[model samples]
Target: MAVCKGCGVTLQSTDPNAIGYTPKEGSEYCQRCFRLMHYDDLTVSMRTGIDPDQIIEQIAKMDALIIYVVDLFDFEAGMIPGLARKLPDKDILMVCAKRDILPDTLNHEKVARFVFARLKELNIKVKGLVLTSKLHSEGIDDVKEAIRMLGHGRPVVVMGRANSGKSTLLNNLFGQNILTSSRFPGTTLEMNQIVVDGITYIDTPGIEIENSLLMDVNESDLKTILPYKTIKPQIFQLHGDQSFAVAGLARLDLMECDHAACVWYLSDKLQVHRSKVQAADELWRKHYGELFSPVPLEENFRVSTIRKNLSKMDIVIDGLGWASVSGQISTISVRAPKSVNVTFRKAML
Candidate 1:
């Protein structure tokens, strides 16, 4: 059976409305990809063909070199638990995707070291880490060289959480646009295998994200959430009670603090609203969906609050990026939608 070159689904000419439908036999691309490529029209992405855990289980059972893809901007969202325990005795290569979106002045070695340090702190074992940007064709050769040296004639498996650019990297390696790449999650529904120089490269389905804001948002909101270009840290200095609303996604309150600086690492498209506590609340209540714009509209997100104390820490909100808060702030309050994971860890800068 011939699979669609764009989405890797079995091509069929029987149904005009179904997924992977082609005009006739010998068609290389599906109608869905055809419309998406030419008219920018998107279709409903499918799931449920295979469980994400089952795919991981199969990969663990096989003797392969795992190329674990991760988004550097949304690092916390990509860290799957028990990943090391599942793939025992297998060489894991950590590919940090979307490296071009980070500030250019930052030292590369320092960033790489930070990645290794963070992974070590999480107890995830990996042979080496490579920073890549599929958009700019960066780190492609280095990644191929790593695969060549580390694979040792074993098949390669690429896996990561949704929107981690798993398909984008595959297209980069294939030297053509074969896989369907999109900003939204659930783009790849099944595992796909492609041959490169007689070796197999497997593209597994992205791990579904439960607590992500994307899960509860509209498809059009992806442009505001996903960063496409380099992001400059928005710096703020605070002394007294101050609050910030991240486009109605989360409300961050630096309450009763002596002195501190909070650096937000988020998409340039999302605006950060900063003001005094009283004004912040008034504004949030009045202009959430309007002024705050791109607000979480689907789910009626309850205002869940979480408090954390830190000297220098990264305040993470699941799918969204984190904020590096530093100084004498004894307590911080995070008010966001319920089910969204709000936690802190040692600063990863």
Candidate 2:
């Protein structure tokens, strides 16, 4: 059976709606990949149906070296909890992708330290770590060198969360766009193998982030939420009770604080509206989609109250950007999609 060169699905000319469908039998790429490559169109949502546990099980049975990719910007969401325990005995190399998105002034050493510290906390062990950016063509050589040294003549498996840049990283290493990659989550539906410089690399389906805002929003809204360029932190000084509406997708309200500095690191396209905390509810109820869009399809929201005693810390909205806070102790209320994950951590900046 002929398989699609792009997404590794069995090719079929009979069905237009099914995956791996092509108008012709001998086409190199399926119609889905063709549209995504040339027209930037997405025909399928790989978020559902694919089983992540089965994917991990298949990986565990393979003897290939594992190359775990994680998005640097959405680090917490990209992490596979209990990954080390699941893939025991396999030599894994962690690739922190999208290093270009972070502010350039930030120290790389500090970033590395942060990554290692987080890894230790998560109990995920790796043979090595490499930071990569497709925009600057960074860390490709380091990845190649590490693979050569640690691969032990086995096929290399590339795995990570959806939209984590696994396929893009592979294309960067290969010096060509041989696989289908997109800003849309779940581009790769199956395991696709490619050989470059005598090294066999297998691209697997991206593990879905169950509680991510990315999963909840429409594709068009993703353009504004996912940062394509380096972020310029938006700094806000809060004196009293204040609320910020992040494009109607999420809300952050400072209920009590003496004085605090809140810095937002997100896509420049997103519009953040500032208002008095007393008026926030009325504003949200009155003009959610009109004034504070693009909103999620469902209006159901979950409010989380966070008491921050740490002088400097980050409030991370999974799959969305984080807000770093400093100064006096504060009480914050985050209103976001009920399914989305919101938590606090040590400041990334």
Q: Which numbered prediction scores highest in lDDT against the true structure?
A: 2
lDDT of 1 at 19: 79
List clashing residue pairs in candidate 1: none
Model 1 CA deviation exceeding 4 Å by range: 47-50, 297-309
Per-residue CA lDDT of candidate 1, range 1-349, in tens? 7887766778889988887788867988888878766776666555223466887888888788999999888877888887878777889999999988877877779888888887887789898888999767899998999988999998888999878998899889888987877776866666778887898988877887767777766678878888888888999998888898999788888876677889998889999999898788789889888888787745355553434455688888877677888877756778767767776777777
Error of 1 at 211 (Å): 1.8
- By TM-score, the best candidate is 2
lDDT of 2 by residue, 74-189 (tens): 99998888888899998999999999999999878888999999999988989999999998679999999999899989999999898899999999999998999899888888
* Model 2 TM-score (2 dp): 0.98
* Backbone steric clashes in candidate 1, count: 0
Backbone Cα, N, C clashes tallied per candidate: 0, 0
